[model samples]
Target: MAPLHSKSHTSLGSRKSSIFNFIQQPPQPDVYYVGVDVGTGSARACIIDTNGIILGLSERPITRHELKANFITQNSTEIWNAICYCVKNCIRESGVDPEDVFGIGFDATCSLVAINEKTDEPMAVGPDFTDHKENIILWMDHRSVDETIEINSSGDKSLKYVGGQMSIEMELPKMKWLKHNMPGGINSCKFYDLADFLTHKATGSEARSYCSTVCKQGLVPPGVDGSTTGWSKEFLLSLDLEELVEDDFRRLGGIPDKNGTFLSAGDIVGKLTAKSAEELGLSTECIVGSGVIDAYAGWIGTVAGKVDNPTVSNKLDSKNNGTILTSCGRLAAVAGTSTCHIAMTKEPCFVQGVWGPYKDVMAKDYWLAEGGQSCTGALLAHVLAIHPASNELSHLAEASNLSKFDYLNLILENLVVDNKSRSVVSLAKHMFFYGDFHGNRSPIADPKMRASIIGQSMDSSVNDLAIQYFGACEFIAQQTRQIVEEMEKGGHEIDCIFMSGGQCRNGLLMRLLADCTGLPIVIPRYIDAAVVFGSAILGAVAAEEAVQEHIHKKGKSRRSSILETQRSQTSLNKVGSGVQLGDGQHSPYTAPTATASTTNMATLAYASTQTGSHHQFPTMTPMTEETDYFNQPPQKKPFSDEDDSEDEQTLSFGSKSNVQKGLSQKLGNLSLKPLTKTTDTSPGAKLWKVMEKMTGPGKVILPSDENHPDRKLLNAKYKIFLEQCYKQQEYRDLVDGVEAENIKG
Candidate 1:
């Protein structure tokens, strides 16, 4: 909530300056929101205000087990415990009273997690079957490749809703693989999408978000006709998954919740499930929220309600017919180990070669169009690690108390000074990297595709590494550019880009993106915890369930209450000749002729005044120039016939009026201010060293070996942070030199 400003009363001079300043403050101090994100690697939580200010954040990595190639799984026990720990740590760091935390929300990857509710045990969805008790089908796992093709061959009616084909990465295929591979598994257990599982874990409710089911599971959302809703038993039967259809789609999930519909953020996700709370060292009072898919959360954070004070035209108000338009083909690229290019549309339109036109997956009213490569940030890391210059960079980074990345950035910056013609984006000229390291996720959707590199050399110098790394970035941007272009051809229009997650933080990456895409990228100044922020906002919304009714009653035409306060200089004086301050006549003087005065207060008034040409006041005024500030006509944009024609039409819409096009669904707001500043010493740097020492010399992932680059070079921040737990050590200190204390929950 922002401070209300009265547009009617504000003077022209002060209004512009005051509006930006006022919106910075939250409307209420006690209100708090939390967002939690579970990526492939870790679960993180962020505490924020209505104004998107992050108060606190924490993260913990969940344990994962990889039984064989293309078979990735995680223990539910580990993931749930990690979630609890992160939530508690966020609460403690925010220093907000539990009562102040109004709501919470969750977002996770579209991974598959299975549990046996009846037996209270885990069912294995693995190859060797050793870990039958704790099994999950990770999104990246390609074990269901055959099962996916089999399902796709059915050409079921539901296939029309998921852009005409299902893939191994989606839920249905994974579920089928689980049922077929482990015969007793489906009979004994319950299946949950990771997002829904987090929500169920939090709220003790089995409600599934529309975003999850439609995009990943191919659940046919209730068409405008409503009769078409629910899973197609006939379709499942065709795929030999009749058991799942016979279960009334129970195993596939049916209870649906809309995106941004809150459950609980810091409130009880059913009293922390007792046993779970104990493991996290938290009380049952610590509330949890229903979770969302990670990319969906990123979408939410990027395109939640519009900012009150926009520097340029409030695109939110101007675009797509002036209603709060659901994003029209907005591309939300969640760049990390891989990049997910997510888009949404009003009606179902299947584009060949893209992942989805999944209904109600990203937003309730619109369908989602997701596309991405198998590798982005991850490929960059691989290229850097194999470079010969990596060891020299690592040694410098260690001695200088900086991460190798930061140290490399410094070197790049120095190089730019000498060769002014070359930009960071241009460094990729002689190098190219393939994104299909794992496989092409979208456009091609080919799991068999392998990585291809062009223009490699025997020389792996610092310059070579820099050029190669920069090329990897350009490749990602080009990939996104390609995705957006393909989306437009498929009846969706992508106007602007909203990026988040790991890669968005890099200046080089962002600049390259803006240049390549030719669209203004609006990066929110929120915490990088988009997942948690989105969840927290939803949780806040859920806690205030009555708000819907209240808003309905208030009608949809509610303008944000803009409270404007006037602060003008008022002087009192005696107008008599030779009058002194002690004169009895105290006449309040109102300066009629606005002559430019020496006072700073008067200077502001003169500056806002315009000349006949309608140009803004020059930065410096010559003494000879007449200070005709007084009697200067009010400076306003000259009214034109075009303006009058546009102004005649009322643009008011309902509170939930669809307005801006190309906005992401409400995911989460991340508090990323801390990451923006350069630090003398980074926790990531220290952790790498410690891990290096722990592993000892001759290790492939060493800090000092340039030829044998450490695995941390993969992204701006290594994915290892998602799992690496830091223990308190004297050597580990904050960049500010503060002793590393125990991370508070």
Candidate 2:
């Protein structure tokens, strides 16, 4: 069906950019979503449009179940058959139109997954792997290190926004080490949160994701519109683990959707189940929605200021006084293969070791926090696969067709052009890189911190693996300038740095994170599989479904053609420069910039009221699924765990001023309370506390040369040798001579 302006696939890895293809038309009161995500390895899928663009994309990879230690696992029937093989190969490479898609969503990696509830089957999480299809558990499996040190020695005020400590990576110390080592492996069990098990595997509706139970199961706490969100039951009986609050919490999800919906992340949590529309070929009248926690869909892929339209993220909201954030607080990081960061505020500040201020999970009434880094792109492909010039730079990057990280960014741009150090992070002035091999997920939330490397040189050239890949991008931008100086000492006034996963295309780790955290990072315009277009903007704000109405040439609807495309605006060009997809596979699609560019408005006034940020794309016809307008009226699968558990399942939530606020004001004990000083702080936290205690130790702020005096003496000889190798016993004595990852019980 597509073939009007045909070609669309953009991705960016090899930079083939272009757009303007609306799959054989599509523009009227537009609608089209699809998202997907999955993560700890792969399973993407994009297919966007309502002006957040994208159109068609696909990804597949997946395979993990690696056992032995930091054990990982999977197989929710192989991640729902790799999300039905990347959504039928991204709707056959996005010729789109399975009834113009409408919705779908999903985001994963909070990884726990177990199920049964009378024969829904799959439970076994692990144990010499007996396979009820491994039944997940993954999110970096740290086998509940002594039940995360007995739930962080039972302090449990929800362990202070998870920064005060509780590491075996969330979900109640991996369900208390899976009920003390699988004691009868949970019978009619039910645990989910691999993005609410792909939205209860396409809506039989097990209902969770208030962004996967408020950020990785610290168990709900963020919804503040007149309170009452449940589960604390005395912090689950102070960790004796109250069978996860039996019936009421319905296996960790305080049950709401038996056709109710409003759980969040842009609503609409049901539909699609005609056996997930014949295993995702699509169309049981689509609309699944509700799912998150793949770094909150990479913080809904950087939603920019004053709701600068990623299809108007529901005017962000504080009841449209509109502050889904823009002037300050924008962090996001999203680095990929490990590296999180996030940050959003307006209320709860928290900090401690840095996890969250939580609530409204990713985007809404705000307060998210996050901070991570359990290995950046798996420690940059294990520092370029334990380099010995990585097999002759992978056969000279496949004989120069490029891509061994784009031929290691063209061997650090031919050893930094005319040379006088204009960047390869200033030729690793004495290599330091301490990438935390697979630990340190924030401030010092230490999961047994390991990994370091100080000045090595027996010259194993390829320019010493590009100065050890620019010393792992200047020690991950000095561990993001020490996690933005512990989130500006836990108050977060954080001015600039939005970045977005997959190492925001390195341009030397974005200029060594703007010269080691001197802020100014930006990079938005939703490019490449942007966490499946931020899970298809949570399935176009969870599609309203009624076949997203159209009919009336005058009967008027498509919500008045989306209020006449939001009171129209026009201009065109640049949407057609991105082709290359007959299918040699590589199109995560890019082009969504309908107006952003603002930098020097009087030295960083960054203004974006979005004036004529380009618009008007109305043209029509060509939407297919064997059209007769998709031959309506046959949807029967509106959720059926055996016919909606024989109907009448009683599920009502909120209002009449519903003010319960869970058992005794649910916050988990509460303590973390710093961040509120505001007299204009966070220029990357006063440039990372004046480069950590008054720039004396190996001084930095080295870029933006004051006429390069050998680039300010090689940035003061590696800023006094990385401030005399910042301590805590040299990376905790190299993580006690490391040996962790062998996790599952």
Candidate 3:
């Protein structure tokens, strides 16, 4: 609720000044930028200076409507209001003069916002079509699963960019569902990805971001997939969504005859509108940058922090030695209600089940891939809520003034002490959890997958709850390993992970993640605010652009004024070798070289001229068998009595002595040691200078020793984890076969 972490250059001697006093104060010479992030549950705003040091941060919860199962919706109006509230509060808290706020950037969940074109009012997109208030289809909503299946069946070339499968969570599937279900069809409605909607709200520009369009709406960039315009008209026509192709795809952020302006992350959209400025308590001169999905913002916020490890830092710098830069090697895991694994590469890597190899999403000239888990923090919460000892654990945690997670971690440590075990991990030696309660987003890409738990007991003690919590954390870590492995198999050379989220606060999770993945986990300085901070970085870039524009214009005017004076003086008097000014110094003005605006304009012109034929879809390439692992049938294993009786052998919590014996047996010869330490060998140099300036250094947690005994245990457990995943598929196959036979009979 309070400012997460603030570093103020100005003295706080007058901190108690009223809001009016702060507004009336003269603008600071130093410029500030504001970043607004709209997550699933809340809207947050933070004000940062050029150095990317946060001065103030505030958040406000928005209303969510779950009208039915898997039908989550929100009101755009309420979300905007919450954003305005957070911005105003952030400014007031920071005591920053509104006029000094030169730019603002926004990032939100990749949800769909529908607006009526004629009235320019929020249009309903939900179970109750009459209720116009709920205009946003929340990103997590799965009401469009059937539509997703239908679209994926089209086998469009555009689907290749999204890992050969279109997710139901993406905007296109939701739009299809709305078209089929909504009264009057969606012809009169305009759809904006939530991030684009936020930018439009701020600056009144209908322009979209490449991050949103290319990643979610299946808009292939000009150079990729042999498309001229980003939109694939033939693909849309094949899917029977002709309304989107009409009006030059205007409703879907496409321009009629010309290529629409789809700005990259750092590009400016426009200046803030007067209405938006007043609402947000900022100046109208403030520029609005193109927005990105929240997770992409996290990638921007991290990946650039100075790594303390020399080995990793060297890889971040060298280009010739099989080493990739930070943008290519580092993966940003933005975890909150869910966790998104974002990585960028020099070329597109078509990883199956991952969301993208999207171009110009987070950074220019880089391809971005997004793999995610649909539920993580939410999964942990559900696990705790369903446990019988949850209330008791909560009460104990409250009394101790600790969070439930922290308290559980402490309980696990105590268990380790009492059992004389090497580490708390021993307590969960036999426990295993399959964490796909909301479904798997990556590697498997199956929405129907459910969660499973092994090694359960009738005892509902707090100790059992602690073990359950540990298993959940382990599941998150193991799933992360699985996602990383899939990405690597697809040709991504991931080095270390840059994680930013609420989950970073949980040390046990961090440790388990490092141990499970065998990669160092870099924690950003502002762990909880990294995504918002990344948005602030975009705002900073926009502000820098505005300043450059001002300088260019001022320089041009000064040169004009000086030239006129020089000509007048030369005509009046006889000069030396040349017309000399009074001070005998040369003019300081030089013509402004190609700025970002001109370069962008040139790019647009090129794209407009290169409008390739839309009638033909590009030749589709089949994914290799090894890379398309998700499509392959689960490997069959011979049934055995041991496999059938494995559940019966699970340790029961009813007896402490038996539990200890089971843990020891499962752990085998495992012995715990402190995490492995690595030393810096190369000269420390920053790789991403701009990002490093914005994000600063963070703590690094190295993985356990590769040769440790625990590695063997964890490796074996991971095998079991994979087995459980295949076991789920086997169950589904058996049931499906039964249904088919029944129909025949």
Candidate 4:
């Protein structure tokens, strides 16, 4: 291993041919991976083959305890149960043998899960009216707004990682809120980000993922006082929130808890304990991989194919000079209710209001920076729903047997003139909008700043609504443009856009984003609904790590060091009755040795000593280099007439992918292929020679009126109007309040 700190800085110096730490060779055909993704509203599971294909998928709605839209919470126990239900269903539906499954991975929203270690139960962070077991602090909750203001006032250096300002939505401010508001909740065991909690629940591993800790929890950055990694007690003390480390860093992170140690995204945490195997309906042998935040998972899943080779090749280039991909420079926009603008660069670039420069949080070795709109799809729906044209448009959609969004797109198509440069941009130019109704998450970390709409008309016609929708799309695109500019200013060479999440479905939004940003948008087909697959990637990686550990021991299959580490303190006598997933058998928590269900003096002494004065922080493995393909060009896969499959000729909604029941056709054929359109089939189809002039798959309409004077005027005038919004007295008060709070305290 190349030492701990070397892992943090991935892009430096010339080196020899070495295996990329994160890369995994294709496993045996029998091996499979299970991935679980717990988003804000749902828990989804996917069973995948070694070839990066989804074989089966299942999902269940996750319940949230809401005091309002801003105070969202969830039950830890319930989330786990939901995951179990989904995992079992996906595995059963996929018809894969339980013994074939070798690994599993997880990704969850960056919510906080407060639990009582003494009882192994969740504790409350909210009012008493509801169940205390609903102990999660949802990522969207804003109850800690005041606390965030207070922390930002401290002006700590840690704030730089979070864009020089902390949002109420982040963990530290929420930690402050919990400490002050719910005093009883402070006497805790472990406070886990939802993702890490899932890993702990599954494998009894006490390690946290680098994704959640560095990105969400404001962990002390690399090289702080020669520490390898963990919370910064100094920074925590600076905020007067020292309770996070009351237990020798146990609550924040101590040796006592199995999850207290931190693991980078691909590390193996441990094997599934018998209890977790029973709940998940998988074998106890299933290796549990370290988890990640949902958005980061999406980033990995979307860009991995572009950055790394997915095929099984044993060629010279595959080792020393594999495809060096430039996928890192491409920004991934996970657009749904909110849109996260995620970018990666070779080194740290801190842009105020944009959170990160987090080292290797997502892409390996590269620093990740994030910016976002507090609202996107949500804001669009909010304004449109109130318009009078909404009902009429809905009725038209229903009458046409199409969805409202589809109907709206059709209406937009009619509004455009053939061969005119005036696409949706022409109609929306008259109206300008700034979306921060839910508070800006990035490029301006101002939660107090509300949204502004400068253009509206008395006309409530359907066309008006459609035009407004177009304008919102344009405005959101403009916001994205501004974020890109700030990132460029901060030294990230971002040009191409990688889109993911639900918003990628909107063809119009995709086109406008490309035009506004003057960048090509690469929408990986699987990236849109990819959180679960990303988790599976992590699982495969963990299994790879375990394989290496075994190899180092000269091919011993004895329990992995990580697994032995977790159960090392527990005596063999404590083996409780456990359910076995395979062949419907029964067993104990561990089959390591004989069982009598008794504890000895040595066990107690060991546990205490590990957590007491003599305790030592877990040593991290030296950082391994991430796959070196992100800066390489995508291999040009030329299209050929022979590529058309006869089977695809009649693919439709009613068609069943599994009607043929081929293994490749399983789970509705979730493909990782790049989405492209046939250039000859468009409006320029007849003139094939002339159509070669077109390069992009999407019609950007930039050629039409390339230098329209109106576009310049709109851009300049809108810039001034935006300046005025921030310069207004109300905006100034919001800024002043942030300043006053920090200065006074």
Which numbered prediction scores highest in lDDT against the true structure?
3
> By lDDT, highest first, what's the ranking?
3, 4, 2, 1
Each candidate structure's TM-score, on Cα atoms with residue i matched to residue i, is 0.66, 0.32, 0.77, 0.72
**Clash count for each candidate, listed in order shown:** 60, 22, 0, 15
Q: How much does candidate 2 score in TM-score?
A: 0.32
- Model 2 local distance difference test score: 0.54
* Candidate 4: worst-modelled 10 consecutive residues by lDDT: 593-602
lDDT score, candidate 4: 0.58
Q: Which regions of candidate 1 deviate over 4 angstroms?
A: 1-19, 26-29, 128-132, 183-185, 224-229, 254-290, 305-313, 320-326, 399-435, 546-745
Deviation in Å, model 2, residue 394 alpha carbon: 39
lDDT of 2 by residue, 94-156 (tens): 455454576778887787888877887787777654677787788778777887787778776
lDDT per model vs. reference: 0.49, 0.54, 0.68, 0.58
By lDDT, the better pick of 3 and 4 is 3
lDDT of 4 at 740: 100
Q: 1-745 in candidate 3: lDDT tens per residue?
A: 0011111111233221311012111112335788898887678888865445566677766778898999999999999888888888777666566655768889998999999988889999979988999999998798988889889899898999997888878899999999999998988899999999999888888899989999999998887768887898899888779999986788888851374678878678898876887788776668888899999889888887654444555566564332224467789998877789999888888888998889877655668899998888777778788899988976786666555665676677667656766556767888988989987888888878999999998979998998898888889999999999999999999888998765665667777787889987876655567788889877876666454443456434332354356456543111101111222221101001100010111110000111221111122122233322111221122211111111111111111111111110011110111111223222111113335555654545667678866666677899999999989999999999999999999
Residues 265-284, candidate 4: write the lDDT tens digits.
75678988988887887766
Against the true structure, candidate 3 reaches a TM-score of 0.77
lDDT of 1 by residue, 1-745 (tens): 0011112122434433532222121123344556677776667666654444455667665666676888878777677777767766666655555434545667788888887767646777777666775577888787887888888888776666565678777888888877787866577667778877876766565666666776777666655335353666677777777667544566656433422132211222443444543444333333454455777666655653233234322453356342214356446666566767777676766776676676545334556777777777667667666788877755665565543343444455554545652433334444555545565566655555555566788876776676676666666666665666667878888766666543433445554565555554544323244445556555543434322222334422111111011012222110101111222221111011111111111111111222331112222232111322112222122211111111011110100001111011111221111111122242112211211111100000001122322111333222221122121111234532643333331
